[model samples]
Target: MRYSKFLLPTSKEAPSDADSTSMKYMYRAGMIRKVSAGLFYYLPYFNMILRKVNFRIRRGMEKLNSNEMKFPILVSQEILESSNRWNAFNKEMFKLKDRNDNGYAISPTNEEYATLVSNLFVKSYNDLPFSIYQIQQKHRDEIRPRNGVVRAREFTMKDAYSFHADEKDLHDYYKLMGEEYTKIFADLGIKTFPVLADSGAMGGNMCHEYMAISPEGEAEIGFCDACGYAANLEKVECKDIYSIDGTYKNKYDKIETPDAKTIAELMNMLQMEAKQFVKSMVYNADGNLVMVLVRGDRNVNEVKLANFLKATNLELATEKEIKSIGSVMGFVGPIGDLQNVRIIGDFEIKGMKNFVVGANEKNMHLRDVDACDIKCEWADMRFADENDVCPKCGAPLHVSQGNELGHIFALGKRYTEVMDSVFVGNDGKNHVPFMGCYGIGLERTVASIIDQHHDEKGLVLPMSVAPFKVDIIIVDTKKENQVKTAEELYNALEDAGVPVLLDDRSERAGVKFNDFELIGVPIRVTCGRSIENGKLEIVRRDNGETVEVEIANAKDFIINMIKNY
Candidate 1:
């Protein structure tokens, strides 16, 4: 492509609204433009890169015998309601109505339709293992989408679903897809690690998210260095490392706390460490009020709590609910005259003796409270932190931020059973087929590449996904020798099937060079005064290594270098 004819707009300054590095560089490089919050106009350059990512993902799916297909972007409300997901995704789904007043939603995913397809085609155990996939746009109404395309409302995703006859087949296929995902991300030039994830709203017992470690990521990961145990913060286990001391140090008595409503204020008044206090948190789990107890220094892992109670909706109890329970907000306790509510305590509380707790009355606290005084069931309900040891190996944990690029789930008949997608087994009995889901975000993958592989200069894009492999610059468009050499080289490279960009515009050399770097082509060939010497200046964008090659050997040399990628 000739620079003068192409709509390649390059800028030196990042947009003011750009928050993340990928957003900044992508905007400045003219690859994308913001249309609104969480929405963007993916320019031609961005589309090219997305297509390359799709190519890699398709190749990987093809290896697994997963046929590529397309599904309707708009799914009917009846189909979603059949799977009991219409209400689960009401907040995030974009709902609309047709002329007849029937409701439809832009699909956030296609599991319902994929399973329907399976039911239509697969009838017996002979067709037990079936897989299909699609590359299409998925929509979600994100409340606060940030990080550019990394968290956009509308983005391209490669989602695949596989149906099998039994649990064993589903398990085997799930493992294969996980392995294939590793290869796919590796081919895209992004390093990712799989972590145990909570299958929220997907209705699955087993799932894993492929996370790319980045500071700008929204997901938090807790991992162990000793035994290679890793999981998402919501799913990581916090082992019960405490044991009963069997010593009561102080007498249990009530004290006038006098308006100390918070842990910090109580600590300041009582002059006690955070670990010596028991925090009582009230939550309404699926409309049933419950009290949870954890140490003051810890936080409740609501995901874990919800999984334990098997509740669909869990949130902090409202002030009215707390008042109805006869407990003041921030002063609720498990030991008080609580009625008709389940009390659950963290496992660590069993070993804590003479700890402090609220009196269930305003401006009052119970001092020297022991485990024997509290009535509750013990469970692991605290979030894992650096201070917590890995449940697999007793080693200190490390927590870091990560972005989810892909996820694979062993759905285990979650949709097939509900949708009545059944197949006749060899025993002549109808059975629900076990299902598996795998997905990768195309735009998010590109954003992660930019986040992981960029420098102060501009993007340091990987050769496999770069839109153009070589950028040919005409330092002086007026110079006959320079323009002639640049055009010849550009044609030669293009004829050789190498994507090349020729900067033949009437612009300064520095401006052309800067734009070339910003676009992040792997190789740059400059046709300047050096052409008079029967040579051209070649620069490698990755390392800034410059070499002069004879005009006769330049095309072959550039093609050979790209082959090494």
Candidate 2:
């Protein structure tokens, strides 16, 4: 394809609205254009790259015996209601009304649709362990869509669902899917770590997320370099706690700490480390008043708290609710006038012999209150930090940010049982099928690839997903010899089964070079004065390496270099 014939409108400056490096470069390289806050239009160049990547993913799926299928982008509300996702999804789901006034939703995921299809088609045990996949558009009403395509409201995704008979079959397919994910990421030339993740709202016991490390990522992962233990912070466990000496001479005393509410203010007045103080918060879990206690320095992991209480509904209690419970806003404690609120404390706080706590009255705080003096159920209810010890191993944890590209989950019988999707087992009994879901955010993968593979100039596309494998540039387009040589090389590369782009416009050498660099063609061949010498200059985008080869050997050299690179 000639550069002029294609919509390769390379720009030198990034759009003002582009927030991330990937978004900026994609806009500048003419890959995509923003239509709204979280919506974007994939231009021709972006579409071409997407097609190539999709083809590669499809090829990998075929090797795993996964059949490809297409499902509707919009699903009826009845389907989601039957699956119990209507209430489970809450506000994150985009719901609309059809012409007939029936409710419909843009699917955020396809687990329900896939399970419905399986129930209608698969009747016997012979169709038990089949996997189906599709690359289609998905929509979610994200609370805050930032970091370019990494957190978008509408994006393309490749979702695969596998149905199985038992735990053994599900585990086997899960392992196979993991291997396929490793291969796919390797083929895309990106380094990713498969880390354990919490199955949020998916109603599963086990899940894994493929995270690509980046400084701008939003998800926090706890990794232990020594023990090789990695997990998402939501599910990471810590076992270390601050030890309190029994011989310490600090005595329990009530002091006036008027209007000093937050931990920082209390710490300043007392001139002590945050570990020396205790923090308490109030929450409403399933319409029941609950109090949570933790160390002042630690943050509460709400997800873990919700799971601990086994409550589907939980939210931070409002100030008005706290006041109505006969407790001051800043002064709350476990020991007070008897109330019907449940008190849950962190295990670290319980282990402390003498800890500081609120006095439950205005202008007063209780210091050196021991855990044995208070009554509450305690557990590891706080967020894991760098100072915490790994639950699996004794090594210290390290925190890093990452963007989640793919997630594999063992859904167990959550959706199947709710939707009444059953299959006949070998015993001739009808049982709910164990389900697993695997998902890849196609646009986010593209964005992550750009995030991991770019420099100050622009995108450094991988050869497998580059819009064109080779870009043939006539450095002096007006020169007859250069033009003829460039055209001949372009045709030769195309005839040799290479995707080639010919830059045949009458542009300056610097402009052409910058355009080629911005567009990120993996390889470039320049025909200039070297044409008269029967030599061509080949430039590699990954590393600024250039080599001179004879015109007769340029095609083979370029092909071999691309394959090796």
Candidate 3:
């Protein structure tokens, strides 16, 4: 491809809205244009990179014997309702009605459709352990789109679903899919690690997210180096490390603590430590009011709370909801006679003998409240942090931010059973096929590769995914020798099956150099005054390694480098 002919719109300044390195560089490199929030107009360069990544993914799927097919972008409401996800995904789904008043959604995922497809074809157990995949667009109405394509509302995804006869077979295939996902990311030159994750909304028995560590990431990861135990922060197991050793005292007294609504205020007023006070929090768990208690310094892990209560939606109760349950917004307590509300306490607070709690009234609190005085069920609901130790090896846990690249779930019968998708077993009995779901976000993965490989200059795109392997820049396009040498080398490299980009534009040498660097071609062969010495300079974009090669050998040199790349 010649730069003069192609739409390589390189720019000097990044977009003002670009927040991360990947977003900024991708915009300046002319790879993508922002159409709106969470939406983009992918340019030819971005499309080429996407194709390379998709090819790697397709190769992995082929290795797994997964058939590739296409499904409609719009999924009917009836099918979603059959799987009971119509209401569950309502917040994120882009819903619309057809002319006939029939509602549908721009499918966020195709679990229902995949199960229905399996039901249509799999008549017996012989078709039990097969997988099918599609590289198609997926849509979700993101509440806040950030970091460009990392959290886009509409983007491409490779979603694969596997069906098996039983739970064991499903688990086996799920493991294989996880391995394949690891290889696919590896092939794309993106480093990722799998961690246990919560199966939110998907309703799976188990799941793991492949995470790439980045500060701009949204997902929090808690990992241990000693035991090699890693999990999504929302799913980390907190051990019961709180136990009081002193003698118990039944001292529960109400006190007038004026204007101490928060734990910090209460601590300042009473001159007490954060661990000495218990916080009473009210949450709306799937429309049911529940009171949760934890130490003042601890934060509730909503994922664990939702999993414990088997609730689809869990959020903090509003002031009106709290008042409806006869609990004050800032003075909720486990000791109150809250009607129709379940009281749950964190396991760490079970051994507490004397602690401060809310008085269940405005500007008031209870001092020296004992554990026996509070009526609640105890469970582990506190978020794990740096102070926490690993549940497996007792080593100090490390916390970091990570972006989710791929996710594989052991879905079991969540969709098949609900959708009435079944197959005939060897015994001639109808059995619900167990399912496993695997997904890779094509754009997010591309951004992650940028995040992991870039430097101060620009993207250090890997050879496998770079838009062009070599960028042949003619420093002096007006000079006959420079232009002639560059054109010859570009044609030869192209003939040798190397993706080459020739900068034949009438731009300054510095401008040409900057553009190619920003574009991040693997190899850059400069045709300049050096051609007068029967030599051209070859520059590597990755490490900026420059070497002078004879014009006679430039084509073979670049081809060998790409062959080994």
Candidate 4:
């Protein structure tokens, strides 16, 4: 690629709306242009990066006997209906009506379509195990797009689905797919950690996500420092850290606590520790009023709460709703028979003896209250914080944030059973095949690579994914000897099977250097006044390491350097 002929629109400033390192660099490097919120137009340079990453994804999928296949961006309503995803996805889906009065959805995923496709081919027991993959566009109606392509509504993804004759076969193939995903990220020069994830609407009991560890990521993961037990924070669980002592005993009593609406205020008024209080929170769980009790210092994990209650939606109850249940604002308790309101207690709350709680009266509280006197269901409902013990090992858990690069789900029979996707068994009877799904977002992966491998100068793209391996900069294109030498080296490098970029533009040396660094071409060979020394300089983009090589051997030195990168 020649700089004079290519669409290399490098800039000094990135978009003002860019909030992350990759978002700023991609916009400044002219890799992608935003067309709307969560929508972008990929330019030539971005296309190059996309192709390289997609190639690695394809290579990894092929290792599992997966064949490449393409599905339509628009899936039919009937297909989604068969799998019940059309109703399950609900508002999250990009649904529209066609001119024929038929509804369709811009597929968020292809579980329905993949199951239908399998129904066509898997008619006999011989075709019991197989996998198919596609690199195509996926759409979702994102309410608020953030972090550029990381949360975009429309994007490209490599999605693969596998089918097996039984659950055992699915589990084996699932393990193999996990290994393949790890290798795929490694091949792209990106470090990732696979952690247990929740398959929310995908309707699977087992799923894991390959996370690119970073503070700028959108997801949080909790892992053990002593062992390899890691899980998404939304699904993570920890052992109870609070336990009851042997000696103390208490009887419930009411106390007057005036003008103390919050825990902090109540703590100061009564001069009691936060751990001595049992706080109650009211929520509208799918329109059913419920009160959740926990230790004062602990907070609730609403995701866990909703999952436990099997509720589609959960939120803090409004003041009007709270009063309608005969509970005063900021003074709700679990012991009252005021209404049919449900009460849920955290597991730690069960062991708490004679703790403080609201008296369900204006400016009042109850102290020395035992949890046995209250009627409620108990479960693990608090978020795991620092110093919390790990569920796998008894070690203290460590927490970190990461971006989800790839996710694989062990979808046992969600789609296969609903869509009637099955095969004839060897016993001459039909049996539903188990299913698995794996996905990697192309743009999100590219952005994560930049986020992981960039510096102040610009993106230090990996050799495998760089737009060009060697950037041959003809510093001072007016000099005949320098231009001629650069052209020769460019040709030599290209002929040696290197992706070379010839910067024969009439730009200044500083401008050329900055542009190439911003675009992050792997190796840069500058031919200028240095050519008078019978040598050219090879500068590494990642580390700024410069090596002087003879003009006759410049091509070989760069090729070797790139091979080592």
Number of clashes recorded per candidate: 0, 0, 0, 0
lDDT value, residue 342 of candidate 2: 84
User: Better model by TM-score, 2 or 3?
Assistant: 3
- Candidate 1, backbone clash total: 0
148-172 in candidate 1: lDDT tens per residue? Answer: 9999999999999999999999999
lDDT of each: 0.90, 0.84, 0.89, 0.87
Output the lDDT of residue 221, model 1: 97
> What are the root-mean-square deviations of the candidates from the true structure over C-alphas?
1.9, 2.5, 1.9, 2.7
What would the per-residue lDDT of candidate 4 be over residues 274-334, giving only the tens digit for each residue?
A: 9999888999987898889889998888878888888866879898888887878888777
For residues 133-250, could you state the per-residue lDDT of candidate 3 as single tens digits? 9999999999999999999999999999999999999998888889888888888898899999998999888999999999888899999999888999999999877654554455
Q: What residue runs in model 2 are displaced by over 4 Å at the alpha carbon?
A: 240-251
Judging by lDDT against the true structure, name the best candidate: 1
TM-scores for every predicted model: 0.96, 0.94, 0.96, 0.92
| lDDT score for candidate 2 against the true structure | 0.84
Assess the local accuracy of residue 359 in candidate 4 as a C-alpha lDDT between 0 and 100. Answer: 80
In model 1, the clashing pairs are none
Ten-residue stretch with the least lDDT total in model 1? 242-251
